[model samples]
Target: MKPHDVNSTVHEPSWQIFLIFLRLGLTSFGGPVAHLGYFREEFVIRRRWLSEKRYADLVALCQFLPGPASSQVGMALGLTRGGYPGVFAAWCGFTLPSALLLIAFALGLSEWGEALPDGLLDGLKIAAVAVVAQAVWSMGGNLCPDAQRVSIMVVAACLVLLVNTPLSQVGVIITAAIIGTLLFKPAMDAPHEALPFTLSRRAGAFWLALFALLLLGLPVLAGVFESQGLALVDAFYRSGSLVFGGGHVVLPLLQAEVVPTGWVDRETFLAGYGAAQAVPGPLFTFAGFLGAAMNPAPSGWAGGMIALLAIFLPSFLLIAGALPFWEALRSQPRIQSALMGINAAVVGLLLAALYDPVWTSAIHGPADFALALLALTALSSWKLPAWLVVLGCGGIGIML
Candidate 1:
């Protein structure tokens, strides 16, 4: 289809876009992959906002860039339907429900967490073990199908565990990308239909440049000013910028950033992550939970909103930046190969995380191991909803 053919589709008002996504935000449970399924149902199949090919291409572009893939797709669809206004409208609609829910959770946890039953929070932490294990299992199967990729995954896990620093994580990703570019020769798929959006390459470049500027400049500004807000922004922004896989992959980065620095305790961090699985919308909203739960000055609704915006800002910027050049980039063999290696490396990172904070902190005894195992079975074998599994674990925790 030609670009103008797509441009000629009926444009929607910003409120209409918000309402549609609001319904989705409330109803769309599950993780990034499930959210994409919900989006496809709502937009491509139901509303006919864009063709299947166009939606697939858009998904590809978002996946290629860092940040939440489903949220990025929502932003792109909103931009297609209602211009820039639709971007914020869609983001607010889809994001706010869960972000608010998580923030409330944080506030409540702070107020009454001690009054709660003994193993309730432990159950939540155990739920994290299952959820993250599921992520690692599924991602490894898909991304590291070959011997070469499996080797890369193992080496990446080893390196991250040995170095055990945020900077090392970044270096590992870069190294994996280089190794992918040189080693793997991916089979190029047939050319996809061009994206219907009419964003200019110049505008795309501007957005891309802005993403880089914030990523690099935020830390320097934070260091110079020594402000907690700036430091929070810098940490969350960098986490959002560097995350290549999905929300689950952000665990180690966030734990490294907040836990060691004493912004939040390891136990609270795991509990919040466990609670995050129950909420609808993007898992990145866990940032809101972490922000609100921080021991620092910004530790309330104010901090939650800041962290939510900082983490998701990259998704918006990246989607805007890459949409124009997606057609050329997606067709390249080297880019495809690099993405494979990067994805495999991400799986490794998650594996390391599962061992450290998620497992070491959560599983303390035989009962803990059994509970996590049960949760994993419910998730992978029974194919139950995550919220259901999480609640079940919590209830069992109370009993145990």
Candidate 2:
């Protein structure tokens, strides 16, 4: 899968792309960082869907956007491969497994609360630590080779670790862009080919407009109709729209919206959250669980569907809105430099996440530490497939 083969010559069937993403949806665990590992291997390395430079650029684009970064990246990759239908296929394949599992949990979640063995889940988390460490190492080598960029990566990691908030992510990326602009002036002057836009800029503008209109109008409609479904839409949509820094960062906004409004009780909410950790897709799929488990009429599959769509809709719209202009926006030398900085900062963000939620929560004892090292060795050196490593870790965890 060479870079040139993907852009102009190669044509992967939508079904083939869907199946690949579906496998990823079912098998990918360990959060966004781990998902990138799986994607880089499957798409960039194996399939050659895009070049490493293009993939990195796509990642850098998603980092600054306010949606599930992994999902958005998958969708954008899909769109690049096969246009609009490909976009839907990519999202569906990647999102469905966890959405269905969480929805099932929502409907009958109380009957068997937290049924997944805690040890097995812990093993998955430990596997995540190793996976993320690998991602940081690989991406750091590619994105932060020089001392100055390495410094940027370190500071970004430090800032996120210290502040541990979405605002901090925004700050770091912004600061990186400013620094990148100044520091990368030399690199920007180098000749570079422009990337082709997948869709018209007018189409992109329309999507952005629609996103804004819905962001503003949905709440008012919810109030006027006084409808639970509409309110659910409004709440989840706002959660998707407002939150920056995907993954765990979206959790608090969601907690605030549903728990306070009595859409879901605290116990049910926490249980679903726990379940979400062990699932194989984006953490945002917790929306599906919440929707399916909500009190009153919205507590069923339909509700779950609504929530899933609401939470993910913003991501689709943003991706649709952004990708068309990306080539033009990024072609500027200053913008290129800034993106370089932001790319380095993204590696730092992944590092911070790896340490906190991934490492701190998983590596609790010497046994856990040993297991993580084993998993890391398997992945990095032994070259075991990621899914196999995940399964092996779970088996080991059960034994422990």
Winner by TM-score: 1
lDDT of each: 0.91, 0.78
Clashes of each: 0, 1
Please list the residue runs of candidate 1 whose C-alpha ends up more than 4 Å from where it truly belongs after superposition.
Answer: 1-9
- The C-alpha TM-scores of every prediction are 0.97, 0.67
- lDDT: worst 10-residue window of model 2: 1-10
So what's the TM-score on candidate 2? Answer: 0.67
Q: Which residue pairs show collisions in model 1? A: none
Candidate 1 residue-wise lDDT, 151-253, digit = tens? 9999999998888889999999999999999999988776677777667777788889999999999999999999999999999999999899887899988
Q: Candidate 2: give the clashing pairs.
A: 1-48
